[model samples]
Target: MFDNFKKNSERYRDYEVIAKFIRLAIPARWRPIGYLEHLVRSRTGGRIPKGPFAGMRYIHTAFGSAYVPKLLGIYERELNPFIEQACALNCPLIVDVGAAEGYYAIGMALRNPDARVIAFEMEQKGRAALKEMAELNNVTSRVEIRARCKRPDLAQILATSDRALILCDAEGDEETLLDPETIPMLAHTHLLVEVHEFVSAGIAERVMKRFAATHKIRRIWQEDRHRSDLPFATLGTTLLPRFYLDWSVSEWRPERMSWLWMEPRTVNAPAA
Candidate 1:
C-alpha cells in the first residue's frame, strides 16, 4: 500500500504521474484502459492471445493496464528476451515475490513444466487470485503459493534449490531482501527484479553495485507499448482506432521503469 505512493509534491508532479494517481484512486474497471480491456476480452475471450503466455487464462492481475497488455502479450515486453532465457534454463525453482495474481508465476510454471514456482504475494486478494490462476491454468501442483517473503524465508527457499530463478517486484523492499551480505545464497541464484525507483530511490544503482562481484548484471528499461508489438495477426481481427490501440497497449506508467537481470558469475553456490 505504502509502496505505491511516489511521494512527489503536487506543485511539481508530472502530468503522467498525476494521471497514474488518478487511475489508482478509482476503480480499475472505470475508463480509458478499462474500455480497452472490454474490447480485448470480447475479441480474445479472456485468454492471453499471444506472447510467451499464449493460451493462459486469468481472473484478474489486480493492477490496471496489466489486464489488456497481458491479454495482448506485451505486458512488460522489454523482458521478453529474459523470460525466454529463463525458459531455456528450465529453472528447477522459480521464486516470484509480489506475485500479483500470478502473471509471471503461473505463466512461467506453464512454460516450464519441470519447474516449481513458489509465489509470495502478501496481499490476501493477490494470493487468492494467484491461487485461482494456478488452478485456472491447471498448474496448481507446480505453483506453490505463499505469503510475505522475508529475508529468512527467502534464504530457506533459495537453500532448497540448487539453482533457482528469482523473479521479483517487491515494490521498495528490494533493498532489504536482495542483500547478498545477508543472503549469500543469492550469489548462486539468477534474479530479475523490478527496481521500483518511483518510490525507492537509487535502489537500481545500489543493486547493481551489490551484485557486480558475483553476477553478470543487465538493466532493462520499460518501453512504451507500440502497435507493432501487438499481435493483430494473432488476434485475427480488430477495427479499433489509433488512440484506442495506443491506450490498450500502454503500461500506463507514471515514469519510466526498469528491471535488473542478474545471472550468477559461477555455477556453484558460495560458502556461507
Candidate 2:
C-alpha cells in the first residue's frame, strides 16, 4: 500500500510540472492585443499594412527598438524625459508644433481627454494624416489641426489663464519658435522643445534665458553626438543629418523624477 501511495504522489508531481511548463511555453497574446488596440485607436482609420507580417509591422520602430506608432501616441523612455514630464502636468492646452501625422498630439489628447490640443504640421500629407487620426481616436472634439507655413502667434491665440503645454519638433527652427517675447505668452504653459545641436551653439541656453525669469527650464535628453547628414533621397532634399537636444519647462516646481535637465531652477515669482 505504501508503494502504491508513492507512485500516485510521483504521478501528481509530474502532472503539476507539465502544467507549469505549458503555461510558461504559451506566449502571452494579450500584450500584442493591447498594442494593436492602442494603434487602432491612435491612428483612427489608418490601415494596418496587410501582409504575412503585417501585424508585426505595426509594432516596429522607424529608428529604434521602441515601436514608432506607440512612441508617437504615448511617452516612451527613448524620447526626451521632458516629453513625458509635460504629459503628467495639469496643463489645459497642448501645442504640438511640427506634429507629424499628429502622433504626439493625438496621444496627448487621448491621455488627457479634458485638455485641448492644437496640432500644427507644415506638410500637407502630415496634416491629412493627423486629421484622420484625431477622428479615429474620437478626439476630434478636443484636438485641432492647423496646417500653416509658420508657427502660430501664441499671444494672439492663447489667454494668460489657460494652462498650456508645448511640444516642438520643428527640424531646425527651435530658435525662431522660442522668441523672447513669446515667452510671456507661455508663462503658464510647459514647453518641450527639441533643439538641434549642429545648427547653433548655446541656442538652448539663449532660449532658456528669455524665460528664466518667469519659467523653470530643464534639459531632458541630449542624443548621442552623431553626424547630422542623412541622404534625403526620399524627400528630394539634400538636408544633412543633425544632432538634437530635448528640453522642458514648468511654471512651478517640477516632480523630482520627472525633471530631466542637467540644471534646475526655482520660480522667483508668478508671471505678470
Best candidate (score: lDDT): 1
- Provide the global lDDT of candidate 2 against the true structure: 0.50
Question: Please, what is the TM-score per model?
Answer: 0.82, 0.54
- Clash totals in order: 0, 7
**lDDT by candidate, in order shown:** 0.79, 0.50
Model 1 ranges off by over 4 Å? 1-32, 227-245, 269-272
RMSD of each: 6.1, 19.1
lDDT of 2 by residue, 58-82 (tens): 2222211123234322223335345
Q: What C-alpha root-mean-square deviation, in Å, does candidate 2 show against the real structure?
A: 19.1
lDDT of 1 by residue, 137-198 (tens): 99999989999999999999988888899999998898889998999889988999999888
